[model samples]
Target chain A: MKTTDNASASLAEQSNDEYSVRITGFWSGRSELIVPALVFILAGFLTYGTATMKVMGTSVPGPQFFPTIVCVLLFLMAIIHTIQILRTRRFPHEDSEGQNADFSTDLLSDLADTENEAIYVPTARPSVTGKRKAYSDWKTLGMVAGAVAAFILALPVLGWILSAAGLFWVVCRALGSKRPLFDLSVAILFSSAIQLAFNAGLGLNLPSGFLEGLI
Target chain B: MESLSLLMEGFSQALTPMNLLWVVIGAVLGTAVGVLPGLGSAMAVALLLPITFSLEPTAAFIMFAGVYFGGLFGDSTSGILLNTPGNSSAIASTFEGHRMALDGRAAKALATAAMGAFIGGLIATTVVVFFAPVLVKMATAFGPAEYFALAVFAFLAISSVVSDSVVKGLMSLGLGLVLALVGVDGPSGTARYTLGMPELFDGMSIVVITVGLLALGEVLHIASRIHRDETAVRVESKGRPRLDLSDIRRAMPAWLRGTAFGVPFGVIPAGGSEVPTFMAYGLEKKLAARNGDTDFGTTGSIRGVAAPEAAANATAGTAMGALLALGLPTSATAAIMLAAFQQYGMQPGPLLFERSGPMVWTLLASLFIGLVILLVLNMQFAVLWAKLLLIPRHYLYAGITVLSVLGVYAISSSIVDLWILLGVGLLGFMMRRYKFPLAPVLIAVILGPLAETELRRALTVSQGDLSILIDSPVTIVLYGLLAITLVITGIQHLRHSKTARSQALKFDTDKLGV
Candidate 1:
């Protein structure tokens, strides 16, 4: 209650953060396990590459020595991380008690050096272990990913202004923007301003594909 | 007297109409980004790195200095108004700053922060004018072995101190080292991990890493979880941000003490101002408790805001000193500055003072100039800056995503780069979601090459004798400092872990530390 008394809007999460973080099944999604799994694969690849590295160095510590050390350490850390994940059975946002400890579920927790781990004073006992759950939001996320892909593929052909504007529209849509017409107008205006700033201001040449020579 | 005269010569250049404009623009832009929850000066500079490619080196650096200091000045705004710190460094300020706002002292909190930042940055920059040359002399004396030792020291200290989990920090370090190793090996001319992509012959650019990880990755992460997270609650902080005489009296000593806590960390390789700001806050809280002057957690306390704000800017100013003198960036923002230096065919080490002495001086002098400009702008317009948070999150992130891609493409004009940007953005999203410390990745990518090159060069010189690394006194001292840092961090970790395990599903109400 004392912790709840002093907490901000974000502190509301800890008390009622009943988000279902059911990352289940071997073939399904254990999103928390993905990072470690990827590192494991990367380590294996690096190990193979190190053994077969070309140009055997004439020096004492050659080109492959450092990679070998890095790969080995990567493997060791990945194993420990995997074991830790499996043993705790905790989601990314959960503490060791398997309770949601992610402050302010917004993604700001990422680069922010918050003591989300085994640190910090426990604020208050969450009176309610609520049943709300957060999902991956793959549909919207996939749309955003698709938008970036489309922009990358179409940049040279569609030009900076058009491709950038299109990317902006799709990303806005992905982020749950419903006003397509207004979004498109804002996208066009924004991209064009960037174009003007870079071209007329910075003197860098951004391609003008369909809008070529149109100012 | 010579340093004083050189500083004056720098002032002469910084006073120019053009450079002065850069300072104002950079300070304003830096403050804008710093006020946003998801943006920081590091990403702003990284996005601008490519655009600054064509500008004169001096003007670009002047703007960079402005942006760097400006971010620190503005970081406490949102913290005071919304209780949502724009970044971790401002979290310390938010504790009491927000309390002050709730107590109807929002103006006082903002004013305390602005003035504290101004004084801290000014004092630290002045110290740099005198202190950096000694550092430069030491950097000048560094041999290959000593350079390698320093890099190792930086790598170990940052990885250990920055992350709570030692394994995660090292893994992040490993990932960065792998990225740094992607291009051709300088000595052997054999590529490490390019995967036959011609665009990667030069390895990855710092612009891509910083922009992708800090800027675009954030956009993607937020988009993925847009609905799950609660929307930030903003309170309208009205009134002019003017501190009273009594407020100033209480804050003045705290400001100096916080700056003292910050300057040493400026030279240390531990990334970010988090540790220093938190320490400043902790010290102020302890002192306040001892004196019974003010209630810390319940009511508002100006000392809390003043100390952390001053510490944040103090660290930023001295970080600049570390960047210019030692060519060793002490924070992520400084790391990007170091990258900007390399992009301009200039390496920021001892040689920089001799080769581009004027530019370094101008950058340092403009820090002072930037602080003056930021104090005026922030004190008068704290409310206006808070309004920036009202921009819709979707549009804000959308703008960031598009601008980041465009900025990266502008640099090299390669389709491959855009693809890599997306890849790195995804990587950044994952890292952010999983609590991976992003500083080690940036620092390692920047320092990994130097470490490898120097290690090999030292080994080559010694005819395969590894003892050459330990033969030098400088290397010995550097490693000794690293050892001490590890021990201190380890003890801190153990103490924190014990407290963490003591609690089940609740926070430790009596204890303080976040």
Candidate 2:
């Protein structure tokens, strides 16, 4: 809402003055473009450095080939873009300047305001009762991360079913399923279905987990 | 007669009970997933990919094609009825279809949209069937340089034309190329970007990248805005959509014109459908305005519904052609479908046409059948589909997140994939938030290795003579097409700017209270 108010105020100012210095059009005063451009340069440098290192018979095209190509393209595009922005900034009358005058101003202001709001928006405080809730939404992220970690840690020793079911249960809980019994049942059923379809139906040699001997 | 015989054989293969079952299942599942807001075709295909691992390649692709077409049709239903487009392609339909829905003519709008889609789809498929063989014959002669050039063309076309800014689009593509560079270098058999991590030696799975980025990323995005009061409500249909003589007469020209606008743009690498649909809509509006149809917006002009709907489906069909022939996916959905093709150890290129001609023909044959199925399904069960809007957003998205995690895990029993999924999901969320188009990223990732391998091989073959790129007629023609596409798009942008200027002038005049 603050962003909306800011955008509206900017629009009002733009409309009020006909000869004001207007920062307008695409790529107008946005810093996010710098991130990708810098990333390209860094990636290119790393790729070039790696490629220079030789290993055995195949030196891997000196790493600089592919990365350099990508980097150069990105750099050229960025340069062309920066030039266009500057050119537009300098020459305001060669084209339909008056027409874009309002539209671009509105767009820039809206974008700037929205970005400001995103940066400045304060986090909501949880109520006293909300703090003690059994299943926190953030716990879902933790559970998923835990499930994946558990799968990796236990897959060799505990096998597929144990790890898969653990994953399934964690994911289901993350999704707000509260019934432990139902969650376990669903997980077992899903694992069995997968085992049957992949191992039995298609003859894929999937890890049978602890159920390796039974069936 | 020879082509007719091949067609008959294709129908025989396509009409089998087993294939029919797959088609129906695919359509049903595709539509269901597509109707769910934020679950696009790419996610649907990626999630179902694990299931396809157990099926025959033919049956797997049969179902994939069914899902692809069905998703397109299904997305339009939500776009029209709920004013929530499931994919960016359906955004234009929301403009007029929602207006018609507000006017209590939802049924008519739905009917017109379905019919227009059917016509556009059928025409495009027919074009594909005839044009594919010739294109394949030409593509067979292409060496690595030509192939690399073609990939460049695709990258240039999609990045420049699809996104609002060419810079952001190219940046998204650079990100994809970087992601693709991870894991072992295929040509030289050395680690590239693995960064001392053994798990990354095999590289990140496309399944993980796609599911994490598209599905899980979408869920996180929705969750970030959970407090927002945006929810889809089911709109009750007043009655069955009727095609009155007058309405049909009015919509017919728009349908034809829409197809004209759509078919060409679809063949181009621009993944976005906004251009053609908007072009059709603007043209129709201008023509109607000239005829003194001042009530165009208020009365819900038939052209409004017809042009965008036809253009949307036409673009969908031609996009498939580009994918099947060039192995370049212009959109996320096409990129996922490309992954599906790769899953079967099949590369969709000139060889696919030569070796799997029957399957290709049959797939094209099924598209015709699928259109009829879509028409019948959309016209009769539209209200039923509109009910999908009532499903709680939290539950739907939560379920999808669960499925996405499961899907990536299912592909490889490795926990590392899950970690990759989470990482890619974060990346996807960032890209979306930053307005970087995701399609180019997918295309670049999928095609990067291929481009590298081919470029190396071509250089080896030609002994490093770069002029070999333009030596062939096919490559020449392709370059010509790319040049023409760039010029045309540039002109179109200029024209669009001019139109915007006129509109602005008109707005200023009105603001002066003249």
Give the candidate number with the greatest TM-score. 1
CAPRI-style class, candidate 1? acceptable
Candidate 1, residue B58: how far the Cα is off, in Å: 0.5
Candidate 2 residue lDDT tens string, A175-206: 55668787788677766676566667766555
For model 1, residues B1-514, the per-residue Cα lDDT tens digits are: 7899999999999999999999999999999998997688999999888888888989999998888988887778988888767776787888889889988889889999999999888888888999999999878888899989978887777776556577778888888888888888888888777778778879998899889888888887777778555565667787999987888998999999989988888988877577788778878878887998765767878898988889888988888888899888888788888989988889888999999998888888898899999999999999899888888888988999898998899988888988889999889877777777688888889888888988888988998888999998988988888888688767766776566445511332221123
Q: Provide the TM-score of chain A alone for each candidate, in the order shown.
A: 0.69, 0.47
Score candidate 2 by DockQ. Answer: 0.11
lDDT of each: 0.80, 0.67
DockQ of each: 0.29, 0.11
Scored by lDDT, model 2 comes in at: 0.67
lDDT string for model 2 (B281-325, tens) is: 767767877898864667566677788778877877887887788
Q: Which parts of model 1 have CA positions greater than 4 angstroms off?
A: A1-30, A94-132, A213-215, B498-514
Candidate 1 lDDT by residue in tens digits, A16-47: 54322332344222456888899988988888
* Residue B74 lDDT in candidate 1: 78
For every model in order, what is the iRMS?
Answer: 8.2, 10.5
